[model samples]
Target: MAKIEQVLESIGAMRQGRTGRFSRGVRRGLYGIFDLTAMTAVLALVVLIYIRFYGEWVIDHRADALQAASSAVIEDRTGTAVWRASLPEGGYREVASAAEIPLLVKQAFIGTEDRRYALHEGIDYTGIVRAAAVNVRSGGTAEGGSSITQQLARNVYLTLDQTWMRKLNEASIALALERHYVKDEILTMYLNEIYMGRGQYGIKAASRRYFGTAELNRLELWQIAILAGIPKAPSAYNPVDDPERAAGRAKVVLGLMAEQGVITAAEADAAAVRAAAYEAPQQSVVDAAGTAAYAAAALREAARKTGLPEEQLRGGGYRIETGLDAAAQAALTGVFAEDAYFPPDMGGQQTEAAMVVVDHRDGEVRALAGGRNGDGAGLNRAVDMKRQPGSAFKPIIAYGPALESGRFSPDSVLPDVLQTYGGYSPRNVGGVYRGSLTMTEALTRSINSPAVWLLNQTGISQAIEFAARLGIELGSEDEHLAIALGGLHEGVSPLQLAQAYSVIANGGTFRSAHFVRSVTDAQGQEIYRFDPEAESRPAMSAWTSAALAFMLRNAVAEGTGQAARIPNRIVGGKTGTVALAMKEVSQAANRDVWFAGFTPEWTAAVWMGFDRTDSGHYLTVPGSAAAGLFSAAMGKMLAGR
Candidate 1:
């Protein structure tokens, strides 16, 4: 009865309010101490009761199960890791270490949710007493307390079973941990064991996930304190979630750190400033593809050298060493963006184009364009799109073979009248023949009737084989004779067609085009090497190719490609037209216009057309427009460096 009275008297004293020197339960000496000892004994008895109820029945079993769960997760990398995808956002992704947390972002966590983490062994007895005293003083239970060790015990071993049994189990686990590990060690374990924000189960991961990058040994004062602040409801203070709240909490941590001499007041002030004004970063700018936006496609093609995964190549931290001369790329983008080439009508929608530069010896692709809008599509249509080579493919089948036959060199006479062979009658642009003309004259003029004459004399099979050797893959030789006018069977990709033209320019040696230079795996092991083809074929002897080259020279001199002429540099190429095969006139009659040409050191091809096949969008004219684009692309590519 006296023990109950003492408890009531202490509660009543607390009810009135007290934090200083003894102002509660005034009494005489012997009875006062006896009452104190009695209260102490009761507290011990409560601890013992909690330990007994929880210690053996629940804690021991749970600890064993948790250990097993940890073991099972030991090798499951996903469960151990945190970051999984390569995001467009700029930063390295981090994963958790042994703890199911992101290691770099988070550090040791405090059971900061508990108000009395440090002063108690596993549970806060004094806080429990004070809170009970206050609660009784007010009318009912008001506050409770838990130590770091107790919180860890609950998190690791006991589910949130609100029953007394669960509380008893938590108490036993706390006791076991306290007995097994020293107080500091128990605190350390608790710090390492708690969960933080962003799906991170530990502090380290949380730290790295939010702060960009963090290293334990190198974390700044703010970084460490920022981590310290995150253990208490990470979402509530996540900078991305609630920047203001997070900053406020972090300031509190900074204050604690300063008080503890972890950092200075000055340091905290600077960190506060940095946090308040943050700048998002752009992806690192590289210098290699400097000027040649036209070379972007070529660079993309060159990605084959790294053996990088295609996704990574297109979007990863890839440094592509393209054959693109930046000056060349920029020049093309600039010129195409001007008033010369695009249609004057809302400007040329078809002005968007593709260009490729191929090295003749072993066909190394030097440059390309997916469109006039370089890098917009991020794809090189020169290699990836199959479009007609137009009259451009004519030199390989009709002109080159006839020149090499000795029976018909450039000077040989050929009739220019429209001729019907195999139900195919080839005509001139306006159906007007120049009567008769020499082979060189015929080619210089790009006259269709004479080209048919040459093809008939050489046979379509021979012509097909000739084009095949030049890298033009014709579907059938037995088709129409109209192809002598440069009509193709199945057509060819700009890349392949570029190489075919390159073969003639490079003395008949065909280098297979390649993009990838070398490739190393994720582990940095070399996995592939591209072999540049070194052999030359008999497609045409140097003499015949040289003669054909000479004849096409007039194209830029005074012929159809006079617009493409560059002063003093000898260039040879042909123009092509996709002939508006669509309905609803895009422009006038021009379908697609193209120019595939070569210099001694560089072979470049350019194609201009509407994005779609609609006649209303393509060139209404024949080959003049493609020639203008070709001239501009080559001018830029060969300009400076």
Candidate 2:
């Protein structure tokens, strides 16, 4: 019995040992299989990431996609493209090569935008992790981990969406850029591709726009810091828009440079001081003669005529041919730029002025100035602003229509006394009434009562029709005797007034006032052409136009417009002044002053006033102020003719 029990125990122990050995072998085999599968999956992920980093699409389309769009060229009458239009990105970009980029500019940008730009490959995994951790802690995106190459990739190839897909794409493209281009080349492209503010792209364009120079090497360290800071938030840090904010941002950039050892602490402190004191160059990037207004107007006209959007007109590489006589435009610009040509500042606000010159022979806008000191793209007052013509409207709405009626002649006598039409009393300027005066004398003296009387006699409907024939459209609201004194519901623009006077200058023919003469596409195919004949029509009889011209010539020669007389030219003009809204304001404190005048070859309208018409901002000068400016500008234009 003992032998049998021992044998059984030994058998059970042997079976238990065999079962444990089998179980251990199966567990080891399963662990080995799981390890192999995990290793294979990781290897596949690495291979996929490598392939994405070296994307064929990114490499193939890089050159073409990165190429900047060509700017549309706006040419003057001489076919010289004096200006280049803004690109689709709302600015002008002038690409600069690595050689053109200065060392300080590069250092400033790298220090401020990407401190680890030199050390990072395309994707900064450590930075991403750090930024992600911070964002997670804050529950918001408070920091960016993108390097310079990533920014370039996003600017050139991706939208600014915060989706994971966009991030993936940006990372892939950035990796591709790093793989293909050297560090210096990538930095150069990044500098040339970034947008700084105020319709400017690239450091070169920003330099030219803000500092008034395209020479990057000449930029001060403060200016370089300004350029560096602009890319983070362009609109917020634009020096032209907000100098204090821009200086603050620039100080931060300078500090970054100091921290990076690119600049010493003392150097950074000096740059910060200069940055605080910096002012945008008053001189525009446009020619010193200031063809910016003309170029802007020409671009607008090109867009209207070609049925293309202004953006397409700007960057489609179209050639816009304008009627801008360079000499005439320069003459107008020069007159506006001169402080002496305008009234002294009132209430610490300088007077603003606009002028438009048209060639009556073809109704081409020869020259224009939108404001006293413009940077080429703001409010183009000549074409955009409409102000009361005052006495300047007498010829268009009253005298011209009266003459065409055959009921009045230059010598016809009319009363210049205070008169009322339906409780609307029209008084002569200064309330002095000449009981009766010849039509020529009334016009020459710019008597308001006679103009109202003449319009009453001509009939408001007839006068409106006649004015329209001369390219001065009046609405139903303007069907009142007050229109004779330029009191229309909607006043006329400088361009409109110039066009109306052009009919008299050209002996009764009216042609549409236009700036763009023609436009050609990138392939030089004519897309638009202004046909003067198509826009031509007889606004009045030659006899009436001649009589009116004779009277206006007399006005310029001996009457209120005497200041507009140009020697050796058959100058004809009318002086106009709109009173301020407040009756308490002195008569001399006018809201607008104008001189609409013409020579045999050219017709022009000059307007000067404050943009606002409050008592503190009213013009203290008379119409003669604009007349004198007209004389100076016209003399310059006629000199070369």
Candidate 3:
């Protein structure tokens, strides 16, 4: 009985030991699962953090990022892209189709860079572990395990920052790309996006630059391998700089292709042999493409009107539909760019000119130009520089206000003798004023004395207020009576003057000057649009505007603005010329000449002057030069229509 008890106890002990073993195994399995769950949660949290902060940068620049293929285009009134600019990469690049990319090149890139590209979803964990191990062994950055998509994310969205945070951000963006695009699209974008040496930004551009031909399908296996290996380290393995290194990199690519079963050992050997004997040719310098003045102004105005930054507009793959009449702009630019416009007798100086033409019916800027020979964006005087308008403001300040206040008429007689207002005495051109002339005659001849008298009669504040209602920006220093004579603290731009005159032409309604008609994205989705008929602010009474227009017609017919006469169409305008009083003969005197005019169809302003402040030469001629340019430009424009 005691032996039986001992056997029972031993059996019980054995059972207990087995139960203990089973519990420990269950705990071990549970711990393993817990560890995996913890790791996954940590990864998820990291991804969430990335999405919360860094992911927005990728979204903001996604349009530019995708524009790796094409540039932003500025279109003309005909809805045709008139000018193009690649703001990010600084030049044009082509997007490659999968068929245009050689099968061998694809194989070489995939084999050498990311062997598991077809298996992983943007990030390869196995490759990451391997790279981490290698980096730990080397005590520094010994290997990069980024996939092609990850490289694209880094290239497009993120800067090359060697930080763990940047890597995390890259992984997050790569995941976003995978979610957005399919595998083939991602691969094609990557292959086309990687920047190669030389001003080239993509594989196709690099191929054209290095091979001197855009035909990539015709490249030899060795050439394909060379081009494929360049995106890894473009400068280090540039074929032109170090042919041997480039060949060495190509051999590695070939070996990887063989290992990946893309090519046989024999094929790889042949490519290797060809690479050793290959010689890289020198690259030629390519000049940057030029942008027209009207297109440049339209681009800037598009940015301003839409509140999009210029950089964003440049790379956002935007199709800016501008109001620029291409033919009109071309004619306007040609007229101002001519050397004959700046005659030797008129100062023998280098003269710069700016002009803006707006449709009187809608206030849409039809044509605009700045410098004669610049790239059109440099110093846009048409909308940037403000010069005194001289007598151009007289009609706005004196005559328009006088008519609106019912205190003056076109036939009302005013003394045109020398006049003084608070130590400021104003005179007509050459100090020769008609003794007494009607309001219409005074304005037609731009007689300054009578204009000052009219300003006193209308009250300077009322005149300035009236001008302000017409979109003329005046300052505190503009309170002086000289404002009646077009002397302001800060003068006006051609665009501003054109817009102000457009008010008179549009029957006393104010319309802000705008260049872009509509803006569309690359997908042809309308992003922003300006309806010219939306402007409804009233500047003056229609009767006053008509009275002013009638007088201006007289000016263009037989008075100071006679040079602006157009035979076919009834023209009305005001001429202004301001001479800078400097003390130097060679650098003493310069004139800012202006003509603000309109037909029933368009209101335009022309300005001519030197870019610098101290030009010694002054214009000896009357304001006829500016008026003549206006007439020529308007004639060409109307004839084209």
Candidate 4:
């Protein structure tokens, strides 16, 4: 009986152990199921969020996804196209259609830029994974996995930033592009929009730039391979700049083409050989007309007025109407082209000159000559390069301000003796100073002493304020008596001088000098129009302008600017010259010479000097040389009037 009771208890204990194990198994299975369900929910939420962002950010803006690339036309005052501002990077963009692209060209680009381009749906997952692994191993971005579509999206809409957000945006936009356009259209746009080397954009421009031809069908297989390799790194693989590197890149492209079965290995090898032997044609220097300078200025003004980037303005297909007087441009260019019109070259260094003409009636820039030899596309000197105005500042800073202060008149007598102020002494030209002279005589003679004395008497702050009113901004460092002789920290440009002189020509009103008169979009909608009233402001009293004009007219007629006088026109002007460094002062070498003057209809300024005024390169002539250039240019500009 006792043994049976003990066996029953052992069986009961065994059953309880089995039941506890079963309950524990059931709880473990339930926890595993719950975790799986939670992971699935989290993944679904992530996918949903991605879809929401993709739809809102990309799909809704599909119609305007691709920014149209077109060349902007710059027109003169007569509504004639004077110049065409090329796409960003500086070359024309001739957008080719799908039909214009050759099959070989397309194959080369596909093989080199995007392997499996046709099989991908806007994004190449395999490429991305491979690139990720490579980047991880390299610990940097050694490879970019962007498809052709993704590149287009980045070039057009998104900035080329390495941030994840930019990458996501690029991916989304590329997907939208693929969805909106067919494969052929996408390819065509890509070909037409990619920036090639040498300031070239699009296949057509790049072809012309590299192969001296724009016809895509005429390109050799080797040339096509070279073109295919350039979009990877434009500057690095530019054939014109570095042919050996370009040939190596082209060989890589040929190998890719052969591997992808686009061409036979033998043909690829032959093309690579031809690429290795290819030599880039020597590019011709384009002798751009003076109108190109005007167009450049107009393009800049259009960008400023419309608040658009220069690249956008250049390629937005807008029509920019400028205040360019064709006749004036012709006259200025004609004068600048003639060696006889300029002073003789000194020490084997050719003298460079710049000029700017403005219509005082509306502050419209009529003409500009940036350099000699019709090199208008080089450094723009008229509006860009600044040099000392020398005594030119007398009228705007000293005499004009003095007269405007009502404490002095054109006839007011002032001391012309050599004087020192705050350890700075100034002397007249040739170091000759009369005892005393009227304000008119002092200005006519361009005596430095009286000019500085008048500035001191009128107060430097008051003179600077008056100069600012005329659009001649002075800096804090210009607060000294030497400012009376046009000595400033940074001197003024010819455009600034012309603009300042326009105050007297306009009878005391100041107007901002501008090149763009109006701008119209491709659809013929007027986007910007110049408003004279908005830019005009009172710079001085009419009496003061009249008095100064009278004094300046005498200066041109009988003073240092006698050569600047124009017949049958009431001409007024000032002559200025900056002496060379003290070592070369005995040679009477002028570092920079200027003549800023005005007629009733136009205000103009001429500047002549070397880019660098060392002992070897300095002007041997006086300010009268620039005055003569001013007379010659202004004479033809005012011929009809």
Error (Å) of candidate 1 at residue 106 is: 9.3
What is the per-residue lDDT of model 1 for residues 363-426, given as tens digits with 9 covering 90 to 100? 5555556665555345456767776666777888788777666777878889989677767777
Q: Indicate the residue-level lDDT of 57 in model 3.
A: 60
Error of 1 at 307 (Å): 9.8
Minimum summed lDDT over a 10-residue window in model 1 is located at: 68-77
True-structure lDDT of candidate 2? 0.86
- Candidate 3 ranges beyond 4 A from true positions: 1-70, 92-182, 191-291, 345-349, 522-525, 531-534, 583-589, 615-617
Better of 1 and 2 by lDDT: 2
Task: Give the alpha carbon lDDT tens digit for every residue of 178-205 in model 3.
Answer: 7778887888888878878765666776
Winner of 2 and 3 under lDDT:
2
lDDT of 2 by residue, 1-641 (tens): 99999999999999999999999999999989999998999987986686575454776856677766646777788886577776765668766668878899999998877777888988777787888999999999977889899999989988999897788778888888888889998998888888898877788878878887768889889999999999989999989899999999999999989988989999999999999997777755344467778888888888888889988777766888888887777777776778988888889888899999999999888888899875567898999999998999999999999999999999999987777899999877677997999999999989888899998999999999999998878898997888989998989999999999999988998989998889998666999999978989988999998999999999998899999998888899999999886877776678899999998889999999888779678888899999999999899878957
- State the number of backbone clashes in model 4: 0
Question: Can you rank all candidates by lDDT, best first?
Answer: 2, 4, 3, 1
In order, candidate lDDTs are 0.61, 0.86, 0.80, 0.86
Candidate 4 deviates by what RMSD? 10.4
Candidate 1 vs candidate 4: the TM-score winner is 4
Candidate 1 — which residues are off by over 4 angstroms?
Answer: 1-322, 344-352, 375-380, 534-539, 581-588, 614-618
